[model samples]
Target: MADPQEPRMTAKRFHARPGVEDWRVLFWGAHAFYAADSLTHAVALASAVAEIADGLDHHPDLDVRPHGVTIRTRTRRGGGLGPLDAELARRVQEFARGEGYRPDPSTLMVTGIAVAQDRDADVRPFWAAIMGYEPLDDADAVDPQRRNPHVWVHELTPPKPGRGRTHIDLSVPADHAKARVEAALAAGGRLVSASPEGWTIASPDNHGVDIAIWPDFEDFGEDG
Candidate 1:
C-alpha cells in the first residue's frame, strides 16, 4: 500500500521520476487527459481511476466530458505533487492501457487573469463578488468549480495609463514554454521580458499576455 503521508515532491522531481510521462505539472497540480473514442469509454476510465484512488485513499478531481476525461491530482494536506499522486497515476495508467485509453499530455494547460491595481483590496472584492468566485487568498480569486481561469490582483507600484492594467496568463508544462514563445513571436507578438518565472509578452494590440512557467526550474532555460 502506498503511504498516505509522504515527503513533498517538487514538480521538477516529479517529472524526473520514471512512469509519469502521461502527466503534466501545471499551475496548481498535476493533470492528465485521456482521449477516449466515446463518452462510454471515458466513463469507464474514470471509474477505474476512482477505484485506484479509493484504494490508495487519495482522491483526484475527475472531469468527464463527451470526448475524454481530465484527471487532476493534488495533495490534500499540502500543495503540489506528493509521492501518493505518482503511485495513483501509475496504477490508473495501467488500467487505462488495458482499456485502450491513451493520454495526450500536450493538451494539458492552465490559464488565469491578472488584474493590475494599486488598490488591490478595493478592487479584489468586486471581481470576486461579481464573478461569484471564492478568494484563494487576499490578493487572488478562483472559480470554486475550477472551470474558469484564476483571477489575480496584481499590484502596480505606480499606476499609470497606456500601460498594462491587466494581463492574460497562459501556463503550461516547462517543456512547452519555449515553443509557445516562439509561436507567439511568429504571430506578431512582441517580446517584453523572459525569466525563469516565465515570459512577459505583449500582443500586437499592446495587451499584456504572460507565458508562465510554474515549478520554476532551469529545465530548458527561458526563451530568448
Candidate 2:
C-alpha cells in the first residue's frame, strides 16, 4: 500500500494516467474536474460514485445541475491530488462511459471578471458589496451562492487606456483551450495574444476576454 502521507501527485503525473486521455478530466492544480450530461445521469453517477467513495473512504465535491454535473476530486489529507484521486477518477470515467454519459469539456468552463486598478483595495469592497460576494484571502470576491463568476482585481502600475481596464476571464481545461479559442475566433472574436496559460480574445468592439487553463496555484473558487 502507498504511504498515506505521500506528497500530492504532480499535475504531470496525474495527467499521465492510463485511460485519462480518453476521459474529459481536466487538471486544475491539486484538483481534477469532470463533467457529466443531464441531471438524471448526474444523479445516477453520483450514486455510484458515492458507493465507491464510501468503499475507498474518498469523496469528491459534486455539483449536480439540470444541464450537467461537475465533479471535483482532491485529497484534503495530502492537500492536493494523489493516487487515490487518480484511481477514483479512472473508475468514474469507466462507469460514466459505460452509462453513455459522454465527457463535455465545455461544461467545465468557469467565468471570472478581472479589473485592473492602481489600488485593488479601493474598489474591492464596492464590488463585493454590490455582488453580495464574500472576500477571499487574496482579496478576490466570489458569489456567495457560487452561481456567479468571480471578480478579481489585479493591480496595474499606470493602468491601460481605452475601455479595456475590465475583462472577462474564462477558465477552461487545458485540453480544451485551443478548441474554445477557435470557436470564439470563428464567432468574430479575434485573438489578441497567446500564452501557455491561455489565449486573450477580443471582441470586434475591442473588449477583451481571456480563455485560460485553471491556474495551478490560484484558487479561483468553488463551483455551484
Candidate 3:
C-alpha cells in the first residue's frame, strides 16, 4: 500500500473519464472545420493550429486538408471530459467563433470559413481600427488566449484590385454602438454605412468586414 503522504494514482488523476462528455457545448466532442482552397493555404491553417496548441500546452489531433481540416481533442489523463478538457474545448470553440466559423447545433455542423484578404501593407492597423479587435503580438499569437482568436494575414500571392464587400453586419447597442464605431474608426477603420439603428464599418480596401449597431430593446421604446 502507498503511504498516505504519497500521491495516489487514482481515476481522478485522469483528465477526462470515459463516461464524462459534455454535448451541449460546441467544443465538447470532436470538431472539424471545412474549406481550404490550396495546399499552401492548408499548410498555413495547420500552422495556425500548431500555434494554438503550443500556446495551450494541450495538443490536439489534426486532420489537415487542402480544402479543409479537422481538429479532434481528447484528454489523455482523464480519458474523458474534465476541467482541463473543458478548458481546451472552450479554447477551440472560441477560436472557431472568432474566425467566423458558424456552428450548427444538431450534428455539430460547425464548418465553413470566411476569407478576408488585404493587399495594402498597412492592413493590420486598418482591420484593427475597424473591428475593435485587440491586436495580439507574436508572443500572444502563439499562446492562445481566451479573449481574441488568431487571424493570419498571408501574402496576397498576386495583388489584384477587386470591388466587392467582404464583410458582415455587427449589431450592438445603439448607444454603445456609436462609441464602438467611433473607437473602431479611430483605430484606422473606415465607415461604409450608418443610420439610427447602426453603422457599417469596413477595411481600407472596402472588404465586407462591416459592423452594425442596434438600439437596445429598452431603448427601442417598448413598454415594459
Candidate 4:
C-alpha cells in the first residue's frame, strides 16, 4: 500500500494509473475536459465536479465553457500531484460517465513562451511590464488571471538572433504531441527537431513552435 504521508505524485506515477484516461498532466496540474451538449449541461457538470472536489477537500480549477467543463487538479502545498487529486479525478470520471458527459482528451494543452536572452540580461521585467504578468521567479513570470501563456526566461550566451531559440512552447500529452506534429507537417510546417518529449517545427515563414510533453518542469507552486 502507498504511504499516506507521501506528499507528491510524480508525473510518471500519475500517468501509469488506470481509469485516468480522462486526465492528462499539463503545466502544474492534471487536467480533464468534458464536453456538454449545451450550456445548461456544462454548468450542471461543473457543479458535479465541484461536489467531488469538495468531498475530497481538494478543489480543482474549474472552467465552464458553453460546450464543456475543464477541471484541473494538483497539490498546491507540495507543488505537484497529491493522492487526493487522483481521487478527485476518478470521481469526476465516474460522475461524467453517469451524466453522459463526453471526455475530450485531445483538447488538453498548456502553452508558454520561451525567451532565450543573454545570460547576464534580465528580460522578465520587460515582459512582465508589457504582458501584465507577475514575476514568478528570477527567470519566469505568469499571468495573474491565468488567461495567458507563461514566460520562461532561458539564458543563452551571446543570445544570437533568429536561431529559433525564442519560440512558443505548446505542451500536450505524450499521445497528443505526435498528432500535433503530424498536423503541423501536413500544413506545410518544417520540422526543426524531434525528441521523445516533443518536436520543434517551423511555419512556412520560419516562425517556430515547440510541441512538448507538458509539465516539462514541475514544482510551479501555483495555488491559483
TM-score of each: 0.84, 0.72, 0.31, 0.86
Show pairs that collide, candidate 4: none
Candidate 1 ranges beyond 4 A from true positions: 1-7, 76-79, 119-121, 161-164, 216-224
The list of candidate 4 runs beyond 4 A from truth reads: 1-7, 77-79, 161-165, 214-224
lDDT of 2 by residue, 1-224 (tens): 23555655655666777755433333322233345556776688788878878878887767776555667666642125668878887887787778776666555766789977664236788789999988875647877555577888887657544323789987676766788888889999998998777789999899999887744323332220
Greater-TM-score candidate between 1 and 2: 1
lDDT of each: 0.77, 0.67, 0.43, 0.77
Q: Candidate 1: global Cα-lDDT? A: 0.77
lDDT of 4 at 149: 87
Query: Candidate 2, overall lDDT?
Result: 0.67
- Residues 26-110, candidate 3, lDDT per residue (tens digit)? 2112334535666676666667767777887777666665665556554422112234444555565565556644333222222
Candidate 4 achieves a global lDDT of 0.77
Query: Which portions of model 2 show Cα errors greater than 4 Å?
Result: 1-8, 22-39, 56-58, 65-67, 75-83, 160-164, 214-224
Worst 10 residues of 2 by lDDT: 215-224
By TM-score: ranked, best first: 4, 1, 2, 3
TM-score of candidate 1 on Cα atoms, chains taken together:
0.84
Candidate 1 lDDT, 57-148, residue by residue in tens:
99988999878999888773223567787887788777777778888866777888899876323577889999998887556798887778
